[model samples]
Target: MGNTPSRKGYEKQPEKTTLFKKEPTGITYRIPALLYLKDTQTYLAFAEKRSSPSDSDAKILVMRRGSLQNGSIQWSPSQEVTSAFLPEHRTMNPCPVFEKNTKTLFLFFICILSNTPEHRQIITGRNKARLCYVTSSDDGQTWSQAKDLTESVIGKNVRRWATFAVGPGHGIQLESGRLIIPAYAYYVPFKCFSFPIPFTVQPHALSIHSDDFGQTWRMGKMLQRKSCECEMAEIIDHEGRSHLYCNARNTHGHRVEALSESSGAYFDKPRLAPKLVESRHGCQGSVIGFPAPEFVPNDEADSIGGTTSPLSPDTQTWLLFSHPTNKTSRRDMGVYLNRSPLHSSGWDQPWVIHSGPSGYSDLAHSEDVEHFACLMECGKESELEQIAFVSFNLSDVMQTVDKREKKEL
Candidate 1:
């Protein structure tokens, strides 16, 4: 742990507003997916409205619209996406990606059988989930009917998977106009030669991508490593080359990372980021890339293990990640910085934004305001009490890091 930020100053809190609160009727909101529209200066927050806190209890998808005003977000009331569902099935995992050229918002999700749990599918070696999406041309005011892409996109590959799910967060659109939706599947290996075919399920991360805008789609090759519930970002290295960076959930005590040079068509072997520890049993995290700042203080760079060389803005891409910081439990929602996005190291100790019980989160960067927004599950007693929204800038992250550095010295 060379100069890693200390775990002090947990009491310093950022201003947050609860966008989706839990109800006394056992209705809970989980799996937040956030997206920011640069053109309209607006934010779209999505989540699963579950009958209870369990995955099998997920009921439907809901969203809220937030407008930037006076440096704060004014969020509208939550609305149920009735059109983004199939009859008699439960909707879950709201993964939204915006196609800038057509100004269309595609909210991708999986519909599982009403009472079918993921574990059951894995054990039985059968898939009962359908890949679907609903598009919104005018932001999220109204959505088109859900379209089932299971047969068209996945097609024959569905037989290899016991189960699969898209991002519980947001997706990305690359500079070349390719839309990438981070996803994972529990693959059933070859069956054993027995009366009852024995199955071994292994999870791997992959992407559902469309190069010709949203007109056509296909699945990318799966990662060789065991990863799941992932998010992707496009990073331009210092040498002016673009790469797709994937950070995924794993049970190996550390997060898994892989890079794709072919715009997500395939990925290289993944390496675990030792600095980024995973919560017990694993939890979903979010990653996004933005242009590096024009100047960075030497002390700050050294403290976070970053490069100090001078580089023009937009020449290199820096990353920000959000997840639960605690290794043994899901708590302390933290935001981490990686000045060197192309490398496995240089991930600084996180700036803990929410210090109490917290769970799945999504991060979005607003270029116009140079602010990052996070929609997360946090509460005093439980992480599932409500879905809250918070925003901070680079200065705020550095200030926290700077304070911790002085305390350590």
Candidate 2:
């Protein structure tokens, strides 16, 4: 194991507020998705309310509205998203994306048959999940009725997929006004049809994009490498070029990283990130890009092996990733920094945030508040106990990095 710092040395830790607590009646919350509106200084946090901790027990989507007040977040009570559902189906994976031109928020998710597990679909080679979404214009106060897009968006192609799902986290809108939703599909080989005994299912990460607002959406080509639950971010390189970066979960020892030059229409061959090790079976992670900070003289930027400084002539995009730091278990939520996002090997060691059992998490970068916020699953004994929210600034991250360097020396 590397020389990771303990949580005792931090002078000030970010305050964590529980947004959704599990009930005694076995009602639990999981799969967090967060979005920050810079114009209104509002935060919309979303999750799946499940009857139990199992995936097939997911019932509905719940949300909370938080406003920045005096440098702290004031979260409102949780509210069920009544309009984002079908009659007899269970909702999972609340993926929210915002469009600046239409001033609309799109919450995309998958509606699976009640009591039907994903393994069944893979074995039968018949998909039982539907692509759906609901729209909101007033910052999630209300939503439009759920619209089924399975026929329109993925017509005739559903036969190739045994099952699929959208992001369990947030999506992104590009500078050219295109909306990109990270998704993955389980593909069954052609030979499985004739000989159905030994089923072969492969998961590949792809994107569902819309160019003209949210009117029409199309599917992108999947990555050649195997990947699962993933997130995408737009990164501006040192030369002012935009590249769509994908970070995905895999059963391999490390995480999968890929880049797309055409705004996620297609991705290049993926590589394993040696610095970002994965948990046992792999876990969902969140990634977000922000403008690089101004460079200062005598800084230790070279120690991280980054090629571009913060004060480059063109704007540079830096990345923040949240995931479990443990290699064998989903514990100790860690936030990692990448000063050079264009390179796959530029990630630094994570700064351990929550020191206990941790699960799925979503990240949102608020430029207005100058802080990064996260909604995660953490508890004393198990990660499914509660969904909490926390916020921290760049200074907090840098301090942890400096302390780790001193300890190593």
Candidate 3:
């Protein structure tokens, strides 16, 4: 498919982009551009609600598809469907999932603490966060009113910042027709909120099984771990075991994805895998069933948590998507794509799908990456994710730092 003609590459170079536009970076950037699929075609997109390195209040844009066999897409008008209704000081995580059983689309997100300069310098104690939800019946053309899922079950002593804690990054319906939702939670950062005693924070990947589709739910086991680590997505194994994955970042800057086996009921603590992504704090990535090619250089690690991704019916391979940041002050970040063989023992390959104005990336799938017939969000993030232009510049800073690291090393 890449056989198209290359115009006189030796004779010319591409135009230089404006510096102000900046490159993708880990710092000042936050994007979990979600991915979703419609027809056989794929589409990629992100929200304008977040305060990523890009601009504030950006629009949600879809990819342009191919005209021939790969038809292109026109940009849809941006929607203000993020956490704009929440207090301006709060940030959130936006995750989308497609439940095949009910044919329903669920958008799960959580509003969290502000890392703004003022908050960081002046505030003390654990910061409180709230979790919310919204739904789209028509492939995201429009969303149902945003609803608060936190008040329903969650009270206090909980940090919504934990991956999937607000809701599952992705969920699976069991053979018994029970809906299994992936979820996580942890103690707020020691001084994150206003409290006298720091809570015993335990990050985890747990689930909520629903017999009536999301109308009612039951709690699953707490994926046991002494450290904070939880952001779970599902993949049905060849042996019929369900594997739950997420990042476990200890005091070290590096992060490893841990896996747990669940049989619709019980779960084991995450067993560590060699998948090493230099997640400074931690990054969310996603996995689907695309059988991506491979990562030649860094060696694709495991564990990804992004907006939304799914496994193909055959489940031979999985497409994993994410936004990349460096171990240093992340900036000049970009979107990356990767793949892993199902039931195999090796980390999958990775590809760079797209780059952001800043570097907060969430990945989803619809049809294509180059030309989106369907992508949820990768271009930018919603304020629900974080709306700080102040920190947005961190992506630029990360670029400078990474260059220096390579030079020194």
Candidate 4:
């Protein structure tokens, strides 16, 4: 499908409902904030109750479920645990992670500017724009106070912002328990933030590591790519060797998704996928990683595959799922798929997996997307399900169909 005209071509299904939607009670249902969910059994879902989205005042509002489709898995009403920040400073971008060595949960988040400058402080010395984190316990049910980790994890001189500030990238907690994070600097003309002198695009990424859990993080190898806010996954080939996949922004203003060799090393430049999910639009989301029984066709070795990927004849391939859009307000979003023979074919088919509204999702290995988190709906937890909990897991395909059927029911 390399020649597929646009990403929107591959059609599978559409989201009947969002990961979480606004209920009539004025509270917004939340997809789990971040990387906390892994297995099917356990995950924390969250949302905020704000008079408005720009209010910056949000509660740590939390929820948990038992299963993906067991029953009603809606979250608790949004709470105003506004935390210790000032009136303008509130919790934002709350993602969950775990350090296997301690069995402790890591909460990584960015403090969006609300009121004063240096107001939303975390690391105690520098007010970082791109990165910061928090720790958690009991499956993200509660959290440690905010700590501005950007300066500790990313260099402060890397990027710049105007009047207000902007932050760098965020990451996921890998199966190896390595905190894989991405960061970049940029200027938002809307924020009306001024520039230094002659206009220049912000140099994007520098990968970081946290050997001592989230306490003391240091910069590792630099990912000189022009992409920012990368979400990563370790894709093991049929040979069991691991590689990394990241979706990023290139200089061309197109939201391009790329691949890499090592767990988080050299990434191939972003190629023009079939559909362009407007990462530039305010509606951009992350790439949730997945592998399936049918991910790679068995005879993929004979497939018209590219040379960048390993030559794999394996049937099981790895999938990159993203909601690409041609334009921001364009509701005709496609859940596009790019396949690579896990054995070595490189990413093939910039094909379609599902389509509908562009929202958020983390790859949950199962028969259905919604079923992955049903554990939360049932109010129970399982230790065996592999789920990557993102800010929002896309609404389930089956649930969407069932809802359509119920309309007739």
- Stretches of candidate 3 exceeding 4 Å from the true structure: 1-30, 39-44, 48-70, 82-91, 112-127, 155-183, 188-202, 208-211, 226-231, 247-253, 263-267, 289-345, 352-358, 366-409
* Per-candidate clash tally: 0, 0, 78, 39
Per-residue lDDT for 249 in model 3? 41
- State the displacement of the C-alpha of residue 227, model 2, in Å, after optimal TM-score superposition: 0.3
Where in model 2 is the C-alpha error above 4 Å?
Answer: 1-12, 193-199, 296-315
Q: Which stretches of candidate 4 lie over 4 Å from their true place?
A: 1-40, 47-49, 55-88, 116-130, 158-170, 187-195, 220-225, 249-253, 260-262, 265-283, 292-317, 327-330, 341-409
lDDT values for all models: 0.88, 0.88, 0.40, 0.41
Candidate 1's C-alpha runs over 4 A off are 1-7, 193-199, 297-315
Residue lDDT tens for model 2, 287-343? 998887775323365467634344552337889999988999998888998888878
Which is the winner by TM-score between candidate 1 and candidate 3?
1
Query: TM per model?
Result: 0.93, 0.93, 0.58, 0.62
lDDT of 4 by residue, 211-319 (tens): 5666677654434444554455556567666666566544354554555664554565545443444444333344545544332222223346522223333423345
How do all the candidates rank in terms of TM-score, highest first?
A: 2, 1, 4, 3
Question: For candidate 4, what is the TM-score?
Answer: 0.62
> What residue pairs are clashing in model 2?
none
Candidate 1: tens digits of C-alpha lDDT, residues 130-232? 9999999999999999999999988988888888999979999998999999999998877554211454588899999998889889999999999999999
* Candidate 3 lDDT, 1-409, residue by residue in tens: 1111112111111111110121244223233334444542323233323334433322222212111234333334334454333555344444555555666666666554444331222133333455566676666656676666665555443433332243323444544456655556553444433442334444565565667766655656565653342334455545655555444343345443545555334565444443435445554444333322222112112124322233233333343433343445333233222234332334432222222222343334333332211122222332122311111121222233333345557
Residue 372 displacement in candidate 2 (angstroms): 0.4
